[model samples]
Target: MALPASSFPTLLFFLFLISHPRCEAAESFSHYCSYNRPTTPAISKSIAKVLSALVSKNPPKRLNTVSFGGGKSKVFGLAQCHRDINATECKSCIEDATAQLPHLCPGQADAGAWFDHCFVAYDHERVPEQHGTGF
Candidate 1:
């Protein structure tokens, strides 16, 4: 059976719509956030202060781990940027990440957020030092 010319164009258009790929920008990259016990008001304040400092003044090397407060109220924090990224871009990414961390994790004592180009983490206890791998 032969189709009419108008019908052929309509069919072709539908086929093209389905066969062609859709172009779009990729969603921003992020990592999982682990939630632990809630912190006391003092500890929470310390965490916020340290994280704010990290965002405001990123280290020269782009990797920084610091501790704030003392005793039970102490908080540990770390921030890092991809080595390939420039200082300005790294700072921007860290700033964005720090801004989002509290919202994403709420009151959790231990939380971490990772972006495509940067990462941030905070906890009540210090991050353990890694030993040499035997395997």
Candidate 2:
């Protein structure tokens, strides 16, 4: 069966809509949790603070790092979104990443989660200052 020429444009538009990637919720890509180091209550509190800071603070740039607590309880965290995304999108992505980390890496003192638009990581020790250098 042959379709009318008028329908071709409509069909093409529908195809394009499905093929194009839409800016929806952030999607998880990968995650890591260090099993060697178990988290103490102090470390856990620090982790919570770090994650909260990562989600609550809005950065001028795409990347942000946060440190909380002191001594053995200290925790360092980093959150970053893709440069192309807008502030709102970045926030959403970071929020999503932060929200998932605890569940994905429960009981671990060091953990990281990678999302489609952003990345979140936290550790009892300081992470690298540079991005893409690994945690």
Candidate 3:
């Protein structure tokens, strides 16, 4: 069947829409989880608690760091959500990161993970405070 020229533009538009695949938002991009030997059960638990708290307290796409427990059991945690995403996305990403990291690096004393929407790290030893600009 022959179609009128006026319908050509509409047909072209529809073809463009269907032919182009929708660019899906990524659930995760890449991750880095340390492979250090397992820590004491107390320290592991503390680290888990800190990570849970971080995801629960998702800020306005802001970076947050906290330390909990004490002595050898102390765990320092850091979480940062991509500023470009909304609060909801930020929270979701952080939650996923926190939940998966522990299992991904079981019994590890230091671990870090990065997703498309957020980044998280938990460790028994805190990074040393840099005295000068040397890296």
Best by TM-score: 2
Q: What is the TM-score of each candidate against the true structure?
A: 0.69, 0.75, 0.70
Candidate 2 pairs with clashing backbones: none
User: Comparing candidate 2 with candidate 3, which one achieves the higher lDDT?
Assistant: 2
Q: Encode model 1's per-residue lDDT on 1-135: one tens digit a residue.
A: 899888998999999988886843222354444555787899889889978978876857677877889998888888877778888778877788787887777887777766767777787877512111110
Question: Model 1 segments beyond 4 Å from truth?
Answer: 1-28, 128-135
**Each candidate structure's count of clashing pairs:** 0, 0, 1
Candidate 3 TM-score, C-alpha based: 0.70
Candidate 3 to native Cα RMSD, angstroms: 6.8
lDDT of 2 by residue, 24-134 (tens): 656677888889989999999999999999988855668788899999999999888777778887888888888889989899999987887788889897772433633
| Alpha carbon deviation, residue 28, candidate 2 (Å) | 1.5
Alpha-carbon deviation at 61 in model 2, angstroms: 2.6
lDDT order, best first, reads: 2, 3, 1
Question: For candidate 1, what is the lDDT?
Answer: 0.73
For candidate 2, the per-residue lDDT at 91 reads 86
Instruction: Report, for every candidate in turn, its global Cα lDDT versus the true structure.
Output: 0.73, 0.83, 0.75
lDDT of 1 at 13: 90
| Candidate 2 TM-score, true structure as reference | 0.75
